[model samples]
Target: MTYRAAIVGTGGIAASHIAALRGRSDVTAAAAIDVADDRVHEFARNWEIPRTFTSLTDALASEDIDVIHLCTPPATHLPLAREALAGGVHVLLEKPPALSLAEHHELISAVDSSTATASVIFQHRFGSGATALRQLASTGKLGKPTVTTCDTQWYRDDAYYAVPWHGTWAAEGGGPTMGHGIHQFDLMLSVLGRWEQVSSMTARRTRPVETEDISAAVVRFASGALATVVNSVVSPRQESRLRFDFEFATIELVHLYGYDDSAWTFTPAPGHEELAETWGDLLTGRPSGHAAQFDDYYRALAAGRVPEVSARNALHTLEFAAAIYASAAQNRAVSCTELTSSSAVWRSMNPGRTARAAASA
Candidate 1:
């Protein structure tokens, strides 16, 4: 049976998914849903979507959708996703699955209790570059990763924050770390498995937003490797870069937004130089993005298995970000184990007035 999907929240991101799903034989663009009438209808007319509704309730009520693509703001992800699963519809949420780990757990509960499945848009993980790295790591070709560096430095102007939800912790969750750097760092975590602890510092350097525009962290992975993570929106020249220092060679990827094989470079250490040929053969031509992940998502739905980028997988990245914020706020190193249901930061990501402050008062 061909699967049907409804595009929710007709924003800039929704256009990417619509374009990706245009000619897929396994999934159909069943309808479009958004609270904004003009934007939703315009999206529908442009994409030639057969149906459109201004509310999820109305679209679900009509029984015209099997999947929901949530491109709405971060604050609304949990409720809308839970509602969709409750109605027996699958959900594909955009990045930053939830505002906090606590909210993410609730969505996990929703998926657990319902027959429907849900996934997050950690699209970078689905790329050829990611696949090649995973193989190298597993095969011991990359050896033990000694250090990893992830830097997401891009400029967002004052006008970018004009959107009511763009900069607020309550809406966007956090700053560059939670919003922009997430994709790059999520890929970092994908390459290096679990994180042991994180020491971080966040500051609102220049952007007149509620959240920090500049932040840095030192993360220790479970594999005894160290990683330095930097997220910033103050850079004049932007780049998304990640580097892994393994025993035999150092692998680095440099690109903005997306990358293919050409964006990656490998340098071998002394006496172990033949790995360059092996690495070149492993890289793929297709750059990673929404389209790459959509291919995997549709394939999973076609089979009986749950999709890639599952809620649990997405939680690792979310928990990692939470650790950074919690560590920065509490002025100490934070372990993954500390971010539990009872944790203060789990309830909110705001640094100025944390959940701890509210609970203590």
Candidate 2:
């Protein structure tokens, strides 16, 4: 079945979603929606969308949209996702899916009750290098993986945060840990099965943002592999990198934002060079990006199954982020299950209680 897709928000991110959807034969960019009438119409014209709606209410009511690409902010995801699912429409959610675990669980419920499905845009996991690592580890070619790392260091000037929602916990969520590094770290969780605990620290530094501009954490995975995670928007030389140290070989991937085969290196142990050759031969040329993942998501959707980066799968990544905030705020280590609804730290990852402080003022 060909999917009739609609783009729900026409912003900077909408470009990525549109560009990827434009050339797909199995999907049609059926409609475009945005609050700005003039801007949305122009966006639709440029993208060659045959239909446009200024209001989501009107768009959902008028268009028989099979899937909705939610390129809006984190704060809008819960309602947009829920509404789409309730309408039996699948959703292609942008990263951080929700601000908290509670919201994520709700989306899962909506998904369970309907034929529709929802998946986050953790496109980095779709890359050939990452796919290779996951497969190699699963096949025992990488030996028992012991150490993994995710580091995202990029600069975001004050001008970058001038957007009204840029820095707020209620809107943009929690600074770099939530907004910037989640794409890379989500890819980390994709390779490593599960995380057991985390210890983290966060600071606002110089960005003048409500949430932290830098966050550092150490994560212990269920597989006995320990990972170091660092998120920052203050660095000058930007880079996104991940490394895996297995009993037999050390695999490394380094790039900014997205990576291709050119960014990955497979280093072999003296006796395990054969294994390296085997790994290098797989997933070599595929690049990590939105289009690669969308192909997987749409194929699974057409098959009537939960797609890659499904809500249930992405919850673990969200839990890890929440655990980081909880750990950083309390200055202690936190277990994965500690961020349940009953936990005070589950209260939306906003540091310093600035909102609460101002609400009482």
Give the top-scoring candidate (lDDT).
1
Cα lDDT of all candidates, in order? Answer: 0.89, 0.88
| Model 2, total clashes | 0
Measured with C-alpha atoms, the lDDT of residue 21 in candidate 1 is: 86
lDDT (Cα, tens digit) per residue for candidate 1, span 1-361: 7888999999999999999887888888989999999999999999999898998988999966789999999999999999999988999999899998889999999999889899999888877878888888889877889999999999999999999999898888999989999998999999999999999999998888999898899999999999999999999999999999999999899999888878888899988788888877887777898989998998888786899798987999998888888888889999989888777677887645664476699
Which regions of candidate 2 deviate over 4 angstroms? Answer: 351-361
Global CA lDDT computed for model 1: 0.89
Query: Which pairs of residues have clashing backbones in candidate 1?
Result: none
Report, for all candidates in order, the number of backbone clashes.
0, 0
**Runs off by more than 4 Å, candidate 1:** 355-361
Q: Provide the lDDT at 74 for model 1.
A: 95
